[model samples]
Target: MENNTFPLYFNLTMFLNLGSFRYPTFVLCFLLYVFIVSANAVIIMVITREKNLHEPMYLFIVCLCLNSIYGSTGFFTRFLRDLLSDSHLISRWACFTQVYVIYTYASYELTILGIMAYDRYVAVCQPLHYHSRISLRVVYRLVALAVIYPAFSVFTCVYLSARLPLCGNEIPKVFCANWPIVKLSCVPTGLNNLVGMLVSTTTVFLPLLFVLYTYLRIVLVCRKKSSEYKSRVIQSCLPHIVTFVNYSITVFCDVSLSRINVEELNPFLGVILSLEFVVIPPILNPLVYGLKLPKIRKVVFKMLSCLKRCH
Candidate 1:
């Protein structure tokens, strides 16, 4: 076949691993998808239903939970389908669409975390001015920035990749990703590489740096306070810190996986690494916030109690 001709569909090679265990894997994955959806939906519902939980912090948690559901749906619907079917081929349009959704989900996660860090910084460092600084207007603007910036940046990257004339159609992973598609291009992809790096830096690293800086300032502020004040700070900040660190590590594993030769690694390990970002954060985010934050914990327990009594 000539390198100029592009295939209509791309084969996702990773599904080959399910050889004898396809049915069991499919059932397990389906249950996981259900759990991710149910957990995140409950968080969103609790936040929106309770008037007392309508603060900026909880609002951002709602956004985070929403993104988890969004991202999980994008991956799981296709993943579950592939696990059951013999064919793992995805159409070019669908492939690009998955890339867009998953990438934007990742970008939104980082941006929201960064915003949460700033919210904490203001609440802890400037208690008297926290309400004025993180007002409803500011929260709306922050949410807007988190949405708009990542959408634009990731759209550009996906747009560039979709325009390329691919020489091959095999994607080694379970999902369609921008980089693997770019690797199949018959022509040089200098422009794609440059833009991918640029987008990654702006969307990923910049937010990471901002989050780190905010936490540093937060730590410094805590140093001057008494034990009681420090205790409160730890209680409030612990969940965000845990969430951020967990997400950062998973993202690092994913980014590192992209650069390395996945073919050389153990197939099970490679698949696990590839699945980390999509699987871990969605499940963990709700658990962390729902358990660690007293307000959310109280509301969740109350809702559960009501359900128990109804039965």
Candidate 2:
């Protein structure tokens, strides 16, 4: 009965008109989840089956798609179930698990993007050294760090929240997130907040800065090149810039919406805003890369033509 007594579950209070819109929302989300998984799977399969695409860049794209699947699975499955259910409560362990997966996915994405930028930088600015510099051993190490560092940082945040004495059980969003759970603690969360800020800086901002720096260096190098060389840079780097910008905006919106007071705002709009990063980026990343990368695009078209012939 005490405020510090930890309950085994907490009710999510963030769905908008759940009873009225349950069926429609569930069907739509189910379809979207299916599409996201399928699209990412097709890209992963194409990359794996094509031996020519077995380079570092394609490997990182595969990792990105894998992360998209990993992250979306954390949110959409439980989300679809809750849409049709009367009770929208999640267990303590489940909430923490979701928190870990979602945040780790976010962190890994930035790391991958940063690595991609570095890959582009090497290919464009130091063409002679690109292959020698970005060896398989180097790529594997970076990939491991991308996966491990985020999980470690998120684990610390979640572990700290787990140790806290919780005084509330209501989450104001459709899914479990690190900050919202921390807000439920009855005790002072200064240390948790501090650790969280540190993690965000190291994981998100640092990687973003690295990406920007790599692009800037690439631009400076491009200024001295011929028109054909400049065009080559644009063809390869443009998609990355677009992907980075798109992801940055959606993620910023997601993080900002989470921290601000939105109880007075339209609940439907708020829910939609929260879901943007999850829904948009997974679908967008693969499509953008598949359409923009010439080699990948040609392979995709060839595969489609073959499928058409068989049918």
Candidate 3:
């Protein structure tokens, strides 16, 4: 592999075995991905558009949806491109762009979860201060963190990952992944892997730990409050818990395996990973937001009514 060669046509990734039904699978993926992305986008639109859905929880959800929009677009659109063309020889720039985009979305997700926990903590620990403290200005700052913080983290990872000389031309997974890209280094990948490990832990585990501690405090407070407050507490926690778990599995599986047995890689496993990150969460997002918050459901109905009236 030459330093400047972006092997577009020669890139044979075994991870995507386009067997007998390749077209069908691609078509299926495109349709399904479109539906899920559109569904979440609509939810975000409705939440933002509807007047009554303008609470702090809905606002945080809007942020989460914005993150999903980034993730879904980054992976789903790229997946289609890879399906259509030979994605083997990713150019240095394209590879770097992929790293930057994926990291940005991933970091936004981590920050979103942390913000959600902090939102809950404020709501629980200081019930009276919930409205005053968690205001529009505060939401803006959190959203800013969700976007900018990830950029910094991903910048560090991509900067480091790009410096390593790739060992070979082929990348195991469909698109460029952080660890997968790190594994391509010609030099000993220990340093890259060490940084990768630290980044992963700092981004994923640390926020999750804070979420846990926050929720523990929340539970204690809820227990002391009225039973009526218990359902409210549960409602706030459940959707974000689902988000946390959805993200945890993807990150865990991605980092857990160091060297992909490229020869033995299952295409379906690729499907599972892609879907977990792209499809499942988007599909679940609306349902989780709708079920967790009555205001969202009410807004949905109101939107439907307005549409019916217009028709």
The candidate maximizing TM-score is 1
Model 2 local distance difference test score: 0.89
- Maximum-lDDT candidate: 1
- Predicted candidate 3 versus true structure: per-residue lDDT over 1-311, tens digit per residue: 56533333224364455766668877988897777777678789888888877877788888788777777787777677667664346666776787688777777777788888999899879989998899989998888877776677778888887777765666666667667666656678777767767876777778878888988888788778887788877776788888778777776666554355645656777546544655666667777887667777777777789999999
Give the higher-TM-score candidate: 1 or 3: 1
lDDT of each: 0.92, 0.89, 0.73
> Could you arrange the candidates by TM-score from highest to lowest?
1, 2, 3
Off by over 4 Å in 3: 1-12, 189-191, 258-267, 305-311
- Candidate 1 per-residue C-alpha lDDT over 61-80 given as tens digits, one digit per residue, 9 for 90 to 100: 99999999999999999998
Ranking of predictions according to lDDT: 1, 2, 3
Backbone atom clashes (below 3 Å) for every candidate = 0, 0, 2
- Estimate, for each residue in 104-164, the C-alpha lDDT of model 2 and write its tens digit: 9888889899999999999998999998999999999999988888889889998998888
Candidates 1 and 2 compared by TM-score, better number: 1
Estimate the overall C-alpha local distance difference test score of candidate 1. Answer: 0.92
TM-score for candidate 2: 0.96
